[model samples]
Target: MRRGENLRSEDYMLIDPFINGVAEFHDRHRDMRLDVDNMSYEELLALEERMGNVSTGLSEETIMKSMQQRKYFSIAEESPSSLEPCCICREEYVTGDDIGTLDCGHDFHTNCIKQWLTQKNLCPICKMTGLGT
Candidate 1:
């Protein structure tokens, strides 16, 4: 069957409620993930993948150890200067301003940045990976 063209009434009746429940559950527990101190390395990684959030409860020691084990690592840019202002807007940085940094080392004002990412997965500056910024 073609994608999304085989749904039956019963499917909606069953799936909609489950989807709503899961959404509600996520909204309620969104900030309540298990702390890194309480989580094994495996558990922490699994939670990270499941929620796609940066865990804050981990200690620097544990974080270093986990990295030594190849458990987790950051893709954050080396420094803010490693990147340039967004190409989409062709603007320069202003002091004490709001900005968003992407995984690819690009920065932009949050409002303009999101619209660009929504349209494509490329850096507004270099058109590299478009996961964030």
Candidate 2:
């Protein structure tokens, strides 16, 4: 949560979707053996268009802004009957643990959900868009 703080392996694991997506994209294009250095202007434009169609291009700044907009709370601040473990880590939320409540109404650890949104702008549970298009 602070500058220069070390993140756990779980944090990296949360971003596996994006990493795997890129790998899969490369795998799909392996046979083409496209050479970027030799691409013409038109070919570059066409490639950019195709990539735009494939991904939303969500960036780190966009993800941080979205995360900041969400409401943060502790488990003790909510009713006991409504308490639930974070779906990302499958861990119970302690009273003092920081939680983020997304617009979709799902709650998760602030760090856990932030990492997820950075890779994909969808709620981990419902696949609903969590950030503005």
Candidate 3:
């Protein structure tokens, strides 16, 4: 129905999002390696299903299955050590806050930058760069 979608079958529909989400997940984990290669095909399938659910908030699993699916994992957990408040709102990033980080390693809450990106894509505080950059 969409640009990259087909109405041929249900499995095809699932495949597209699965592959796309896996691609995103791979980009998000390029530097990390999981025990994926070691997992049985059934286990891998289960993990992929869980990943799909996690990405879209369809399921209520607090932690993702991939956490246990990988080895030598390097996921980006919320940084507790960097307690610095967002440069825009001057508010701390809470447990469920969405965040975006700059190439310069500066971080900001998602809402602030999203509003700013709508106007233009640059950091509100430093002005070094923005979403478009």
Predicted model with the maximum TM-score: 2
**How do the predictions measure up, each by TM-score?**
0.32, 0.46, 0.34
Which candidate would rank higher by lDDT, 1 or 2?
A: 2
Residue ranges of candidate 3 with Cα displaced over 4 Å: 1-82
In lDDT terms, which candidate is top? 2
Please write out the lDDT profile of model 2 over residues 1-133, one tens digit for every residue.
4668887766765657476554333476678787989999999999998878555436767666665444444545578557667889988777567777666877788888877876777888888887664
Error of 3 at 95 (Å): 1.3
lDDT, candidate 1, residue 16?
Answer: 76
Candidate 3, 14-131: lDDT as tens digits: 6586654553343766667568878999999998887784221211122121112111222377465657787778876666676655444556665565555555445566775443
| Prediction 3 TM-score vs. true | 0.34
Worst 10 residues of 1 by lDDT: 65-74
Per-candidate Cα RMSD to the true structure, in Å, reads 18.8, 23.4, 22.9
What's the TM for model 2? 0.46
Candidate 2 whole-model C-alpha lDDT, 0 to 1: 0.71
Misplaced by over 4 Å in model 1 are 1-85
- lDDT ranking of the models: 2, 1, 3
